[model samples]
Target: MNRIIFAAAALAASAAIAYAQDPIVGNWKTELGDTAAIAACGSGYCITLKSGKHAGEQIGNFNGKDGSYEGKITDPDAKKTYDGSLTVSGNALKMKGCVLKVVCESQTWPRL
Candidate 1:
């Protein structure tokens, strides 16, 4: 009985950990004509919390409007940063992050 109980508990724990992996648990690139870099953002306003290459980055968050948000991105390694506003369309994470005040690049990528 003790062994059986332990086995059941272990199974449950493993299942839970597996479920914790979000849908956006993969690599994602920015769309064309946009500069800000982004990854797969899971459901419910979830965004990637990145470090190393891009640290201290930020994006915009809108005022209760769908697909309207602001974000800030930082790449400590590259010693770079991107700041701008964006919106998530039906199948894209649109970004236009910039430095100081310049819109450099943007792109659309399939969510991985």
Candidate 2:
């Protein structure tokens, strides 16, 4: 009985650790009204469109933690990629992409 209890406890602890490692893993509603799914991919997170015209398209890749992340974002319409960063607050995620480290565009996405 003690061994069984220990195993259960270990499972629960690992689950919590996994969640804490990537609090941004979930679906979000983009400013343009599309659904974006962010999930762990390889060493970081991959953002893919789950709805709208761009469904199934991977638009972003980020690596970071504690509500802040940095990586690359793609403009689906333009077929261009830019330096990007993400900031999470409560149920909202602020995404920013920059061109030449000067011109930047930002959008806030709410968790779905």
Candidate 3:
């Protein structure tokens, strides 16, 4: 019985660690230089602008794995949305977006 209890405890601990967010899965600055917090939302993730021009606006549905994700990011000031991609490495996060395949911009946001 003790062995079974230990095994169950180990399994639970491992599962908790697995579901925990990666380093980049927390607060960050956006391309517009605004601060936002990213959190799990419906099998993916959603980022809510914490400050600057887009405060309180949430960008949702970034689906990916292994530090790369893609979704739609909206600019609250301009009220425009673009196809956005995010790549995270260590303490740096690179975000890029294309505007209708005509123009694109990228920015590297350092962890906060």
Candidate 4:
């Protein structure tokens, strides 16, 4: 009986972990053509560059849910940080960043 109870507990834990992962939690090719890994981080989501000049750098934090997020992102190419928003759907993520509500750039990233 104890072994069966433990098995059930373990299964439940594994299911919870799987459910915790958001749909956006995966590796993707960035707009700048770099590779990035996106996953849950510290009560939000984190974007990390895996390849390119900014390899292994955390680009920014995204706070949102249901395929939409707003946060800050670093543009490695330009070496700038700006307020950013991301929308993910069907293996594609649309990322937009604005500099002080003025200059804004958008890019579409596909899952890798």
Cα TM-score of candidate 1: 0.42
Candidates' lDDT values, in order?
Answer: 0.49, 0.94, 0.81, 0.90
Tens digits of lDDT, candidate 4, 2-109: 999999999999999998878778999976678999989999999999999899999989999989999999877677899999998989999999988799989899
Task: Give the range of the ten consecutive residues with the poorest summed lDDT in model 4.
Answer: 72-81
The model with the greatest TM-score is 2
Which of candidates 1 and 2 reaches a greater lDDT? 2
For each predicted model, how many residue pairs clash, with residues at least 3 apart or on different chains? Answer: 28, 0, 0, 0
26-55, model 3: which lDDT tens digit per residue?
A: 888666678888877888888888898667
Best by lDDT: 2
TM-score between model 3 and native: 0.76
Query: lDDT by residue for model 1 over 3-47, one digit each (tens)?
Result: 999999999999998677443333445432223434344322323
Angstrom error of the Cα, residue 74, model 1: value is 2.4
| Prediction 2 TM-score vs. true | 0.86
Off by over 4 Å in 1: 1-46, 49-65
Give the Cα error of residue 74 in candidate 3, in Å.
0.6
Off by over 4 Å in 3: 1-15, 18-20, 31-33
Each model's TM-score? Answer: 0.42, 0.86, 0.76, 0.85
